[model samples]
Target: MRNVRPWRLVAAWVIVILMATTVPFPSGLIETGPFPFDKVVHFGLYAVLGWTVHRAVRAGGGRRPLSILAAWAVGIAFGALDELHQHLVPGRDPSVADWAADAAGYTAAFLASSVLARKSSRKEQR
Candidate 1:
């Protein structure tokens, strides 16, 4: 893997957070019935956030476990804050299910990254 600047990762994360908080959902866009598409959006957005956090941590010299923990923590906390912010929006309200989806996404991304890292390390060893 090429060397990645930690600050770049941080900047990306900040941009993602800003976008997530500032954007208002269009009416009927997230209201797909029978399948909870909002949850999927929450999951995808926070998964990217978690991946960026993990990359930033790793680039800054954090160990794998620490990076995973930090990614999950930051992702979930940010999700909670996003939900709270949504409550203030005219057409939006806070939902616990969204937060759960965010956490699940973060966990999935973190584990996937961990597995990939382990594989890479093993390949380097061999």
Candidate 2:
């Protein structure tokens, strides 16, 4: 059996994020108090995006350094585009804070992925 293409997985996840952003939410649905839960959701969503992008890059035969850089670029670029796309959605105004959260989430995921990959590679070498 052939392995599923990693880039296809990335595209599917991207579509999911886009579809989710296209929906209009009820008033106060996204924000739930002094601490906006919306940012958490954004962070979590983009975290997965980051992980997928990283895996896709590595699967595509990119070197470790290149995959890390590419994943960060793709994750941040998509986050920015998604923020702009929010302009068309009702009840959603794009905020820089959200983008920052997106970046932070992806950065965290990338670092974690790199560490895990290193460990796995070491195990394989043993």
- Encode model 1's per-residue lDDT on 60-90: one tens digit a residue: 6677576567666866787788788887776
Q: What is the per-residue lDDT of model 2 for residues 6-114, given as tens digits with 9 covering 90 to 100?
A: 8888899899989988888665776877879988988888888888777777666665676568668878998998988898899887889888888888878877877
Q: What is the alpha-carbon lDDT of model 2 when measured against the actual structure?
A: 0.81
Candidate 2 minimal-lDDT segment of 10 residues? 58-67
Off by over 4 Å in 2: 1-4
Cα deviation of 60 in candidate 2 (Å)? 1.5
* C-alpha-based local distance difference test score of model 1: 0.73
Report how far off residue 79 is in candidate 2 (Å).
Answer: 0.3
Give the Å shift of residue 45 in candidate 2: 0.5
Each prediction's TM-score versus the true structure: 0.80, 0.88
TM-score of 1: 0.80
